[model samples]
Target: MRLRVHRRGLFGWEPGEDALAGAAVTTTECRNIDLDRMLDPARGNLVIGARLPHMSLVFDRDARGPGHHLIELDDLTTKSFARLDWPTDSTEPFTISQLGPRRL
Candidate 1:
């Protein structure tokens, strides 16, 4: 993924346009990201024994601190998934890890 912040928004830092603005900035890119293992429905408990159905692995980005990503696996069935208790809802199938400052 690449990042280039130009201005700060109400919510958080906003991304710049296609081309860089004034000062040339370093485009940070995360290379060779393998999501195969992390995209498994079974990993999120959305799969049953020998009964894998149509599912959707969805993800939403949040530039907020403490949580940068919100990934969820939906079985697409009528059954509803449990709701998260934002403040303290970090558990299995719904966990968060704090990856500190980026290291070269």
Candidate 2:
């Protein structure tokens, strides 16, 4: 599935915490963000990272499958928002920090 961050005030995956949103089944082999989906008209106005909380993206295949995995986004560093040129290629890595008002 496509995993994306939820709005800051939205219900998180766990109690008292923020969560990410997912839709459409897709492999996690591509380590990149779906900017198009993030900027979808129906998803609402884009506020960048300030409106989103840093969260992990868990990838799994059933209860006992081999694809089980997790990506802890808070552990990585990203470029400043002003430095981003808006990567057009879907394959380009998009770190959560890049969505924020400043570099993480």
Candidate 3:
């Protein structure tokens, strides 16, 4: 399943937030954000951080085990949060703050 974000407000809707919400469809297949090379200053320009309330992960039932997982962002920080293990076979949507390692 593909996660998609929908805009509610008139304009300037948050894409990241939308993506997170869409992830709920299949939380099991969704995994943590890959931030291996996101730390690069050059890449930073493409990695725009946003204040998202939640994130969702979509999964395939027949192909996989469970379904998916969702994550809520309480706060924003430039620290790398470890990948969360799902209770069942599922996916989870996460933000950059939830993935990348903390910069010293």
Candidate 4:
């Protein structure tokens, strides 16, 4: 997938064109990612049983983190998915980490 930036940069990765000055920059990105290899069965509740459906696993990029977490089955796509919650006493970052995006 290609990353199209409108402004300078979202996470300071690349320089964006000045839209006000009528300048636009385009960049291309090609990734050969494997969803199966990046999946987390234990935490993601991907166990096959009577309750668990025999379907494909889906993953989404952690918008607020540096990794990706399991979302839901693609066949039954939904925005709402089960998330792992942290303890109230913990001072960790407000983001979940499953598998980091690999550049392979």
Candidate 5:
């Protein structure tokens, strides 16, 4: 999956899923995203079996300081996904990193 941000909005495309779709993007002033709280599992447990896909995200030029937006899955034909709001300080710069533990 690849994500691109333009004048219109955020756009994502995944092979074998759908070509591309308009994404809901929100900008907020916050830091430290809790994965469990953002993505609630149907089993009432945070640790549930889910298929995580590879993603490539590109931020907008105006967005700065590790800015993050919550992306929701609304398309039935494509692999839906969501993102938690990330923190960004005015003094700092925007940076994106891959979350989760490393494989040993």
Candidate 6:
């Protein structure tokens, strides 16, 4: 699963609230957006931060068990318009933020 932002003006995205189509974000600025603080995975549940309303957290069924589990982000709505395979399992306390119009 992967985290994807919905296309602006589509369903969940309103016209003025849509992501800047071709805006570019610097890598330095990207580092400031904290995924852990946003998701708060340590709280024993999924948390959606105010800044990233379009993103969602996903986990495999096994992850729901009683343990520090690895999971995946649902990428069905990614800017790429496709999902990415989890090359390796991802543990909690990770961050995902949109750095630019097409970069996440």
| Top candidate when judged by TM-score against the true structure | 1
Please give each candidate's TM-score. Answer: 0.28, 0.23, 0.18, 0.21, 0.23, 0.25
- Off-target runs (Cα >4 Å) in candidate 2 are 1-33, 44-81, 90-101
Instruction: Write the residue-wise lDDT of candidate 5 on 1-104 in tens digits.
Output: 42212211243443231322233434434333333343344431222213322322222222323444333222222434433333333333323222222210
> Candidate 6 residues 2-90, lDDT tens each?
32322232334221214433333222222212423433555423433224455434443334354333332222244422111221234
Best by lDDT: 6
Higher-ranked by TM-score: 3 or 5: 5
Better of 3 and 4 by TM-score: 4
**CA-lDDT, candidates in order:** 0.29, 0.30, 0.29, 0.28, 0.30, 0.32
Model 6 is weakest, by summed lDDT over 10 consecutive residues, at 80-89
**What local lDDT does model 6 show for residue 72?**
29
Candidate 3 lDDT, 6-84, residue by residue in tens: 2222223223634444332222333333332332334521232222322222222223234333222221233222223
**How does model 6 fare in lDDT?**
0.32
Could you tell me which residue pairs clash in candidate 1?
A: none
Note each model's CA RMSD in angstroms. Answer: 17.6, 15.2, 14.9, 16.5, 13.1, 10.8
After the best TM-score superposition of candidate 5, give how far the Cα of residue 48 lies from its true spot, in angstroms. 4.1
Lowest summed lDDT across 10 adjacent residues in model 4 is found at 95-104
Model 1: per-residue lDDT, tens digit, 68-93?
45443333343222111122223323
